[model samples]
Target: MLRIWKWYERCLSIHPVKTQVVSSGVLWGIGDVGAQCITYSTARKRLQCKDAEQECKIDWKRAAVTSLFGFGFVGPVGHYWYEGLDRFIKLKFQLRPKTVKFVAAKVAMDGILFSPFDLFLFFSYMGLSTGKSVPQVKEDVKRDFLPALILEGGIWPIVQIVNFRYIPVRYQLLYVNIFCLLDSAFLSWIEQQNDAPWKRRLGGGQGRW
Candidate 1:
């Protein structure tokens, strides 16, 4: 593990953007595989797939599409975002790095700004890539976005607090990508749960925003 991390560090130093992109892509792809497995299990149990030989079939295309999101958006954007965010906070607020104020501001801004944008993009991209029309995509986003944001809201701020306090700016995205392994799965699971009862209840009460 130490050796692998050292090797990763070396690669990161030599080629930051490329490394972030590739790693994010690979991890998100793997996360999608996990999501597929989870979705399959849920379906199998719900439908009572009694065949002993029944197995979860991985969707490589979906995984690739999910990976493209990480590669094309998260990696490059996250890299610059953290870098610029750190600089901006330092300059704009004059809060010293690792200070409580500094970390709190980062967490607040990240949750308020970037998290929503990221989720919006992910849902929109997924819908379009899968051939949904603009209106359909908008509906998908509406159905999925609020629930996702609310659930993630409970978790990510805590994660970012630790990240801003401990992780270096350059390595923060890597740390996030690590957690994104699970996050991607969760998001995929949420997306796969189309019109689920809980989703209807959550989205039902709120009229179109």
Candidate 2:
């Protein structure tokens, strides 16, 4: 465990910023699917199968969509947003600001920018993967999105504030990944709640594969 943590630390320290964000996003997406697979998929059954081929045939389509969403949407955006927030707070503090006021402004700005994007990405990914009609998907997106926004946006700023303040740039990815693991678990639960029965069946339970 210590060795694995050390390797993670090294990866965060050595990789380029873009590489760190993209890799973390991709791994986060995979972790989501992995959690689902372990929690609800046929992999949990210990079934007797022919030559292990069946075991390998988990649902790639869902995983692909999830990964694409994570890598393409979440990674780059998160990187930029984190940078932006850091700069914004620093600027605010430098401009004759009280600590409470600066912190409040920073948190508000972050929520306004980050919440909508987060909702859009998650909802878009779900809509694409589930093949839900546009109206239906949009409605579902609207319904669940705010809760997700509150959940993620609320927690992330506190962490981000600490991260930006103290943690070095080289350690950002590792720091974020630890949070991502928790976020991924919550996201998996949300996905399970929002998915249709048929979609769940197709995904082999909560789209695990």
Candidate 3:
């Protein structure tokens, strides 16, 4: 782990944007694998799968698609977004990094702006990438977006607090990408849930996976 991180740091020094993009893609892909396992486990329990079917079969194609979101969108966009946001807050508001006001402003702006955009993009991208129609993707977003945003909203602000308070601008996105491993799995799980009962409760419709 230490050696890998050292190598990553070296790569980051040489090509920061490229490194973040590749790392985000790889981590999101791994997270999708985790999501598949979790989804399969839930199905196995619900269906009482036989011993022969105990092991989960990973869908590599699906994983690749999910990784592309990280590579094409999250990595590049997040890199600039964080860099720009930090600069804007510093220059616009004249808040020092790690100050209470600075952290609060960042948290507020991030939650209000970036969080919703990220969730919206994830659902829309995943839906369209998997061949869903525009209307279908819109419906998927309507069903899943709010629940995800509301749930994630509670947690990420706290995480960003620590991140903005301590980590440097260059390292902040790396810190975020680490947490995105779990976040990607969560978003994948939510996508796979389809019209689960809880989702129905939140989304105000009757549907099933």
Misplaced by over 4 Å in model 3 are 49-54, 204-209
Candidate 2: minimum summed lDDT over ten consecutive residues — where? 200-209
lDDT of each candidate versus the true structure: 0.92, 0.62, 0.90
| Per-residue alpha-carbon lDDT of candidate 2 for residues 1-209, written as tens digits (9 for 90 to 100) | 99977876676557656666677667776766775665454433544445433444445666666666667766677666666765677775663333565556655776687667766778767775778887776666655555566567668888866665566645654577677766765665566555445433433222111
Question: Per-residue lDDT tens digits of candidate 1, residues 121-151?
Answer: 9999999999999988888899899899988
**What lDDT is reached at residue 98 by model 3?**
90
Residue 201 alpha-carbon offset, candidate 3, angstroms: 2.7
Which 10 successive residues of model 1 have the least lDDT summed? 200-209
Better of 2 and 3 by TM-score: 3
**Per-residue lDDT tens digits of candidate 3, residues 75-145?**
99999999999999999999988999999999999999999999999999999988999989988988898
| Candidate 1 TM-score to native | 0.95
Clashes of 1: 0
| Order of the predicted models by lDDT, top scorer first | 1, 3, 2
Error of 3 at 116 (Å): 0.7
TM-score of every candidate relative to the true structure: 0.95, 0.65, 0.93
